[model samples]
Target: MTAPPTAPATSNAVGRRVSWQTGVSILVMVCAVYLARRHWPVIESGAARLAVADRGWLLVATAATAATWVCSALAQQGAVARPLPARRLVAVQFAASAANHLLPAGLGAGAVNLRFLTRCGLPVGRSATALAVKATAGTVVRGFLIAVLALACPGVIHPPHVPAVAVAVAVAVVGVGVVLLKGPLRRALRAVLADVRAVHELPARAAALWGGSLAFASLHAAVVIAVTQALDLPLPPAQVALAYLAASSAAVLLPTPGGLGALDAALALALTLAGAPGSAAASAVLGYRLLTVWLPLLPGLLALGVLIRRRVV
Candidate 1:
């Protein structure tokens, strides 16, 4: 007779170990948030006034942000052949959003999504493919819009350090475009599309994906504007566009969780370069993050609990 399997002594060790990378990412975010604000009094007073002065505007903006999330859920629907309940998909999306705010490199968001997708009966490969398509679509739409806005707005066009950055970005974009359009690249694209039978079948799925992407990009921009106003930075929409665009680009490219430290630092620096005082820029970055990244985590935790109980992952 075969012996029964024995439990390893160190099975618990894996569960007990702290993630040093996560810890370090958190530490860096903390230091950046704390250190960047030298004139605390100014930042505090400005933030307080803006909060009171523009409460209505902020509310409207927040609603727009929520709508973007709904759009994101719709994008997920695009990739999956079988439809899960919309309400459940939304909860999963919200939970993912919450996690994104809490974790560095956007891992929290990704993990929550993976869990939800798997729970909904999608195989690993399909889930990954779905995620990949959604991500690429979102990136292309957001980046294209931002780039156009940056070029069109004089305020954005004239920002400090922007010229050099723009040239570099232009070169990179051209190079990427060339690569994507070439013969081998075209073949690769054809090969990829060959396997996505489900993705190809649904009518209006493309529209929904694009719509969600556009809405999310707009909401992301609005949040930045709201936070800046809250800090009484007085930055015009143009400058906000450029700063938001550049900072967000850097954050997304960075490998760290949700681009925690990298995002804040880049935004602060970009804002400062755009003529805002350092403290004000820092305050805007910090306050904006509080709403966008941290506060939503509470809802995420609750959603996570519900998900676990439902056995839907």
Candidate 2:
């Protein structure tokens, strides 16, 4: 038989692994801090705006911001039939939010949730598919809301004027690309279609998937509206809500972590376009970002550390 492994060598290996992980974590945190510093001017402007906001309204916005994690948990649960522990799901989401800001797009959040789901007994493929399902539902619901809102507020939601030739060319390019990639695309489509059918077979799961997605997007917009009201911005609630939807939809095209720079710019632009003064619009966007992203960031990071140490995520 081969010689048994040495205890000392195993210990050393484990120690090195932990040290490497710790170093990587520290680097991510440093990156987060550097990015935050770069946005100090926006943060300062938002804080100034917050100083004059109505305290009661601001409190309401804070409460709504806190509820986003609950919405996330519900959406995740709806994505799969496996019953995840409710408290743990919420906690994972809280930690994932911080992790989400550390990486581009949503890779951080997706990784965190995938691990949690796998630990909860899902196979890796199922976990990934669950994430895709939740994301698909959220996108569909948000698009539906945009369509409805645009129809409701015709005056504020003007369609962009793309040249007919450009549209035709883009359509032709996309069609050709799809045709060229039919084999892989067809297989992927089949897998997604199977998962969709399986998921919707359970009425409650189907409802949760669609309903939770809608609630998450709507609540996010509500948070922005509440911030505008707190700042006493002279825009109708519907207009503010529509602007939020449009801006966030457009921001999704960018790959920023938590939509950092892209979202800030879009929010400010949308608010300004909706008739708010430039300063007030900037302040409103900043306040909303402050509540949703920055304030909870540190706490979320701490929670992520705790979860990692406990091996719960």
Candidate 3:
């Protein structure tokens, strides 16, 4: 009698859980459709531009976009001493990119990678630490690239002049924010530093971490540059690269999913500042987004779903 009651109870719990998952999936699909409809005009315009783009240059952009996933996989592998399955790692990065765009900032990608690491035998805490280390390396490499490119293309990205009072206020605000978050920040910093040290102890890991990060950022810039070339945007390659790096860095501040609006606006503005016409700048930005985001999105999501069903991530 007890067994019969327990069986129905277990079935009910499982049914409820499945129903909840179905509801969430439906909600996500609805939101995605709504967003697509809202941005239909922009999507149409980008598609028009891409339709006439130089095939050779567009091919280059596509290749670079694909290589980015491989680079990302390399960086993730570098985040820990243990060897991960290379093929699965690359596929997970592709899926993670789609996941990343679905959530604000990088929460989705981080969660996916965390799950992957845990599934690969890493402890939860260690998995989180590895993510932090990979993120830190990427950040450092991006900033370095920006600084170098800015110097190379002198005057390409002019910093906005701020009033002394505004600068002082910004500094004060940052100081206060730091003070308030000091405890948690300090603990996090310690963990990241510890992981950084451990990862650096292996020369191969260090090289993969830093080198992969460099390649990832550079390839993204290359994609933008290739788009500009394909469209005959009348900007030097170096200037375009500089504009992309600077705009992408600024986009980081907004924390939008996939840096959607923020990156689009910033890249357009940067390209315009770099001497491309408004229409050309817009086309370049759209083309870049098309290749990087829209094209890969469906396939990446499919991969994510497959990984989930297989319990791979």
Clashes of each: 7, 0, 0
Q: Once model 3 is optimally superposed onto the true structure by TM-score, how far is the C-alpha of residue 151 displaced, in angstroms?
A: 2.1
lDDT-superior candidate, 1 or 3: 3
lDDT of each: 0.69, 0.86, 0.88
Instruction: Please give, for residues 84-180, the per-residue lDDT of candidate 1 as tens digits.
Output: 6799888888767765755667677777787788878888766766777778778888779867877776554443465888899999998999887
Stronger candidate by lDDT (1 vs 2): 2
lDDT value, residue 313 of candidate 1:
57
Model 3 scores a C-alpha lDDT of 0.88
Candidate 1: which pairs clash? 104-257, 104-258, 105-256, 105-257, 105-258, 106-257, 106-258
Provide the RMSD of all predictions against the true structure, rounded to 1 decimal: 7.1, 2.2, 2.6
The true-versus-predicted C-alpha distance at residue 53 of model 2, in Å, is: 0.6
Candidates ranked, most accurate by lDDT first:
3, 2, 1
Q: Estimate each model's TM-score.
A: 0.70, 0.91, 0.90
Off by more than 4 A, model 2:
1-13
Predicted structure 1, TM vs. truth:
0.70
The lDDT leader among the candidates is 3
Please, what are the lDDT tens digits per residue for candidate 3 over residues 97-162? Answer: 987888989998998899999999999989999999999899999889888987888878788888
